[model samples]
Target chain A: MRSDRQNRTPMGLKIAAAAGLAFLHLPLLLIFVYAFTTEDKSYQFPPPGLTLKWFAVTWNRPDVWDALTLSVKVASISTVVALVLGTLCAAAISQTRFFGREAISLLVILPIALPGIITGISLRSAFNLAEIPFSFWTIVLGHATFCVVVVYNNAVARFRRMSGSLIEASMDLGADGFQTFRHVILPNIGTALLAGGMLAFALSFDEVIVTTFTAGQQATLPIWMLEELVRPRQRPVTNVVAMVVVLVTFLPILAAYYLTRDGDQISGQGK
Target chain B: MPHAVTFQQVSRHFGAVRAVDAVDLEIAPGEFFAMLGPSGSGKTTCLRLIAGFEQPTSGHIEIFGETAEGVPPYRRHVNTVFQDYALFPHLNVADNVAYGLMIKGVGRAERAREAEAALEMVKLPGYGGRKPGQLSGGQRQRVALARALVNKPKVLLLDEPLGALDLKLREQMQEELKALQRALGITFVFVTHDQGEALSMADRVAVFNEGRIMQTGTPHEIYRRPQTRFVADFVGSSNVLSPDLTARLGGPRQWASLRPEDIRLDTDGHHRGRVIAASFLGSATRITLEIDGETLSVLLPSGSAVPEPGEEVAFSWSPGDLHVMGDEA
Candidate 1:
């Protein structure tokens, strides 16, 4: 009976699925093609020629190196901050009952739900009010605001899905609170945290608008790419950087997807 | 020796609802005790209290002569096999059984050796390398048992441990658990809603209802002489005779209980009733009869003449079979 249903997928649905895949992935393919293009001036179809010169050019640019380093630093720090804060917040909200718990959960996820421009403006004003200098820390702080939400969303879901009996069993088996967390709770939520951290890193890596308001004199990779687009200093170099960004960000998101895809099958669940 | 667990007027309340109300209980050391009740009858709550997962709202609890009210579950000398067999999914069976030893900083080699031996005792030897998810429900149950027993807790709390298995497997585990408890001489406090399981397994059984114990006694005593109407009905679904019916049955004018197996269908009996339903239960046929607007259930042994529903039948029990019960609601 299941095989009969599998064999009868409508042609229109198949076409629609193919179109959706093409629409999402074709631009990424274009970015890869242009990264190798000899045309450094503008977008050209089937470029007059493809060359490896752009790769060397991108590699030699010290400005590109600086921006790449700053972006990596901001993303790495923001992801770490998000991982700690998000997991803690998720554990608190999912495992306990208190007044305003629902409201607190909503507020924790509010930064990501709001527009990036709104978060950026509010953060900029807050930083100004506090008279804090906009250095590398400002960008890290800004990225962490939304990065935390991404992580919390992933973690809270996993925490809620986890059976509370596991914790009880741990304690009953002679584990203290910390020991139970280390042996039982940590193992159950470990993959979820890893996936959330990966997504947070990928989100912070390509963040543009929040970084724009928070960054005073810093040019993160995205801000650098935006500047190069407006002022025209080696277009293919920008495309090469974009290709690298895609690859770098794509790997983690892919990893995160794989990590959480079979998460429902955690052992001893529904038993 | 001190009692394995003692609750002196222990009560746990959640806002307006009383989950475990003013209940006193005593479980002896090395005794197989069962707390049997319907859901929400405080059996599981009392078990949790002994495990130190919950603190009483009032009154004191002691375990082995030690005050247990403020103590944490980790410090308590008891372990539980949860209904779902809460095994750690990430670890293999061996590591799971070794989790407590590891927490206590046992050497890895000894932990492995003991976990293997524990598995062997549970009849799951060499099943250690597999994850809990790979095993069937029965295998997971045994691993949970091994995991808890490996700790050698002074008191072992099993909360509906066999509730998740099939009927045949439940019976098998019940025997295995009883045998294991006997061999180890550990106090086994089992919580179950199954009367048969409690009856067949435990040395003493406490029947609970509405957050209070209706009665506590040996299975034979509880079955043969249930003191309250609730106990009589809950334990075996015996016919609870009203005061008027009790008076008519040659007993005092009080509530009484008559076991279904005690009544026999006799052609010359004085009592006559119309059969309402007849169910064939393998070795016996249970016939429900309406005698003077009062319902009476009678069990007939196999090969006896089976009466059709709506037919008039005569049934009678020995004068001693109708046991008078207390007037408590």
Candidate 2:
């Protein structure tokens, strides 16, 4: 009976899926092709020879290297901060029945759902009112605000899937409160935490709008790419850096998907 | 010794619903106690209160005579085997068993040694390297037992611990758990909705209804001398007759309950009834008979004379076998 449906998918669906796959991968293929182009000035197709000159140029540029290092540092710090705060919030909201809990949860997820420009503008205004200087730390703070929502969603979903009886069992087994969290609760949510951290790192690494607002003079890789795009003195080098960004960010996302795929079904079942 | 556990009129409320209401119980050291009830009868809630996962809305709980107020579950000298087993999927069997010991700061070597010993006690000595996902249902249950017992708790709480197993495995584990309790000499508080599980394993059983304890006594006392209609009906299969029908046999305002095995079905007896249905079980034959508009079920040994449906049969039971309850509801 099941096999009958398996053999009967319409031709339209197959064509649509092929189109969707091409749509997603074509831009990535273009970026890779342009990164190796010999013509260093334009984005024209079919005229440029292939060369590895942009790769060597990208490796030597001090500004690009500094921007890459800054992006990594900001992503690491923001991810850590988001993980601790998001985990605590998820644990608090998951285990207890308190007043306005649903409202608080909605508020927690609001930052990630809102437009990034709006978050950037709001953070900029807030910093102006507080009269605080903008630096690398401000960029980390800006990224963390939205990054926390991703971590919170992942962690809370994992917590909800977890059997409450496990925590109760740990406590009953002569484990202190800390011990129960360390031994039982933490182990159960470890996969979710890793997935959330990876996702948050990827998000922070590529965040451009908020980084532009918070970064006064220092540029992250994303901000540097934006600057290079507007003033195209080194177009091929920019393509090379863009390809590198895509690779670095894509690997973590794939890892996060694999880590969280099994438990993702839990939320669907919960509904 | 003082009672291993005590609940002093414990009551817990979630909003307007009382999950547990004014429950008072005392469990003795080294005794196998069972709380038997239907779903939502507060048996599991009461177990959670004792486990410190929940705090009472009123009253108090004590472990070994010390007030359990503000005492975290890890600090209390009690362990629980959860209904779902709750074995850590990330940890192998040995690490799971050693979890409680590690929490108490036991050295790695000693904790591993004790975990192995606990696994041996549960008869799963070589299963230490397997994840819970790799183990069968029965093996998982045994690992859960080993993990809890490795801590050497003063009292062990099992919340429907065998609920996930098949019937045959459930019966096997029940006997093994009872024997383990006796061998360890630790107090055990087992919760289950299955009356048979409670009756066969517990030294004493507390039958719960609604949110209160209907009765608590030795299994024989509960079965042979039920104090309420609920107790008799919940504990075992009973033919409960109203006061009007039992009035001719005894007094008014008295309901009678008779076990199926106690009622004899023969060709020559005082009371006569027509068989409505007959089911042939492997070891016994069950005949449902209607007497004076009331239905009575009789269980006779296999290979006994099988009465056809609609055939008249004589049914009677010894007067001493009848359990009578006063109008308390």
Candidate 3:
């Protein structure tokens, strides 16, 4: 009888969730519809005509490709750096007793918790103080600072849930330090690491505020879209590019969700 | 056989608490030794110290006659079956059991063969393809044992290996573990808080309290002749009476320990008492009697007629069954 009530609750929740999802996608659907409108100068409620010209125009633009490549490069490099540093920090903090561990953990998470504009301003000022020129590397560094928090949060939670006895058992079975980590700890946390890396990559790909401060003359995809919005002739192309960005970033987020879904249940029971 | 593992005055302190006080013990090769104690009594800590997970604050530990100081768990010729099993979740049964063999760089065919044999020994043949999550609690435990035993170490440490199983399964596994230990002829050092687990499985049991070993002996000896009050009370149900009650019968000790089964109920010429409570436990009826304001519990055979609560009764036992213990020692 109690389980019947539990079943009804999720059914109600599913309907509410479907409504919420429709609200979110309605605006996105309008954007896609307007991308094909022949009346391209202004974003009106209903299109006067429909044509494939905007996609053709978006495809021919070399500038869009340059921006897309730059965004990819920055996101890839930043995600790699975040994965390595974040994993090391998580591993060090998760399994040991030490002074200032809480403080260290807070510091690792603070970049993402703070406002994006604040992070951008601070990075800009710090770069100025160091007398470093703004370039691709500076943009990469800016993205990595915030991306590390995503990976670190996921990896640390994974590490904490992992049973310490597993490591002890591995060691007791005559596996050396590196071997134990390879055979036991790594396998246990593998799904979490993949999920974290994917989330970091998605976050870095779409980030615009910090990228604006860090990239002086170079334009990433988001920054390029901002430039195109301000400029007069490239309006429909901007909508097309925006749709592409959503797809590229959304796929990884979806993949990350699926990867991490089973991890929580497995770790909970394994403990 | 010579001592396979020994702890000489070993102690470990965590902040202000002494988790394992100065303790000395020797485990013979192929012997099934159990460290029995309540939670926080340092039985697990002793197992950890032997497994090289924790360094002693003082004293020395030796494995196979070699000093174990500074030796990490990986270097020690010992393996452990942790209470939660700790089977690798990502790996299937075969790979989990073969982990140790793979670490030693054994050939794939040999490792597979040995892992299968170990699985069969645990009565889980052809379960090699299933992950730990797919198996039941008991199956996971068997996989953990197979993983540990596949390494063929000199000593096997089990820290409450049956602790997570249900009572019936725990009893079944206890016998299987004992038989496996005999067949393998590996020294087994089992740690548990359950007296029945220790009494049924161990060749020798070491009773621990407050980070110190109170007594160590065979199960019969420990049960029949407990040297300390703590051991007598912890290992089995016992009737504790003030020394004044037994002074006329014997010594000057302040307390005397009597096993519940030792007390005989008779109709006359015995210590007269009133029945306070009677609990029928299927095999035996445990009767509590009030004598001179003190309650003494006695376990009588199921067929014995028990008096109603508040009825007069007489309790008597053989003089040899009384174990005198120093006050709270």
Candidate 4:
């Protein structure tokens, strides 16, 4: 029957899907395997033997500590900045009827849409023209451009989906403007903002290209990892650091996915 | 006494479209008033204006003797039960009901106690912990009621509050709403397009059409003597007789209306017509008759001798039953 055909997966298609998943995830599996490798100088196919010595070495290295701390600091600051800017932009764009509103929305998301090199070039030139020194703040500025887009996309979708009557009901029930927003509007979009903030943190943690232009001499974790890859040294340590990077960036994205999964639906609402 | 709410020459326009035209009206304190009209009739807009969600584009509004011009909804002493309930999705029933008090900075323990009492008021005492989504449509409606009533405002504006329920639930809610209004003694200004709801629930009904009130009166007065042709046809089903039919009924008027129940089918009667259709309603049967090429509806109670289609029937009515319209001095 047609139902039977739909219920069963063909052998060829099942194999193809398995192959695709393996192709995407196999590199991460190799990274984990090499992090425990006994060989310190070369990447032998089977990783020769396994040990935990590189983790101790990574913990003691001051350069790795500096890079890790800087990456965390930049990502956190950028996420905070993005949450405030993106939410305000989303509220203005979604809640009002004004001329050139679409243009404003397009402008908010343009930095993310443009190629990273183009964004880097523009930021570098703008900073140069303004005579601003590149430092931690400049690095944060570079990360926040795309971070704001992620937050804006999530926040605007939620703001647009939320029923306007909820705010009206709050007002009619004797809640002032600030109170209405805190009690009604904030609760409605809280999960969305959290998800957007998490995703932005993940993106900023792994960002490399924009940081390359904006950061003068400061080496973030990704930049340090790139340098380590170019000039090979204690190769197993680099693999161990990659494992940390994967975990650091992957946890927030995973949490963000779960947060936004059920956020699109309004409880007790028809649509 | 000053009215609970008053609109003086109010009008709200969205660009070229007049959502609420120049209007004047007053709602007395503790009165159950209904705005009855079809969609886009500006009844909802008028309710929103009272709620201060929308201000009059051109007139003045007053609440409790004070001119409420430019007053925000939060500053006004009025609450609303929206058609969709508009329950806060993030909070449980207790928190949702307590939102107004929380915004007003009421103590947590006191707010919780008041919320429970308010829930009990609407007959949903133990549903405080459940999410609004987990409850049924009727239960959610009660939660919305509890949320608005927790504040105890001077007037409660309901924008088609029972529109989302089934027929049986809607009927039950209508009775409960009327009882609640009487018990609380608060002004209840509800809007709806269902004439049955307006007639059975509200003390006074204002019929609206094309952004203007066609007539406003008590249910009996509006039903018995609808002033405008729109009020006659929209409020209830009526056989709007032409000027010719009006004259034949011994009425001096340009337009007249006759309720379907007023027409009687008897063997000995003044007028004769052919039965075109017979619809058997549970309590009453609506029989359509064609007299002189003009169709009329005659409603007869059940257990009467029913007329078959294509059968000839004689109908009669008292001259006083003819509601002559368009005879203003």
Docking class of 4: medium
Quick one: best TM-score, which candidate? Answer: 1
Full-model lDDT for every candidate: 0.90, 0.86, 0.88, 0.89
> Under CAPRI classification, how is model 3 graded?
medium
lDDT for residue A14 in candidate 4, whole number 0-100: 97
lDDT tens digits, residues B77-186, model 2?
88889888998877899998998888778999999899999999999988888888899999999999999998888889999999999999998999999999999999
Candidates by lDDT, descending order? 1, 4, 3, 2
Alpha-carbon error at B320 in model 4, in Å?
A: 1.7
Full ranking by DockQ: 3, 1, 4, 2
lDDT of 3 at B213: 98
TM-scores of chain A, one for each prediction: 0.91, 0.93, 0.89, 0.94
Q: Tens digit of lDDT per residue, candidate 2, span A9-123?
A: 8999999999999998998899889998888667889745889988999999999999999999999999999999999999989998899999999898877877778888999
Query: Interface RMSD for each candidate model?
Result: 0.8, 1.5, 0.9, 0.9
Which 10 residues in a row give candidate 1 chain B its minimum summed lDDT? B320-329
* Candidates, DockQ: 0.75, 0.68, 0.76, 0.75
RMSD of 4: 3.7
What DockQ does candidate 1 score?
A: 0.75
Candidate 1 lDDT for residue B203: 99
Ten contiguous residues with the weakest lDDT in model 2 chain B: B244-253
Pairs in steric clash, model 4: none
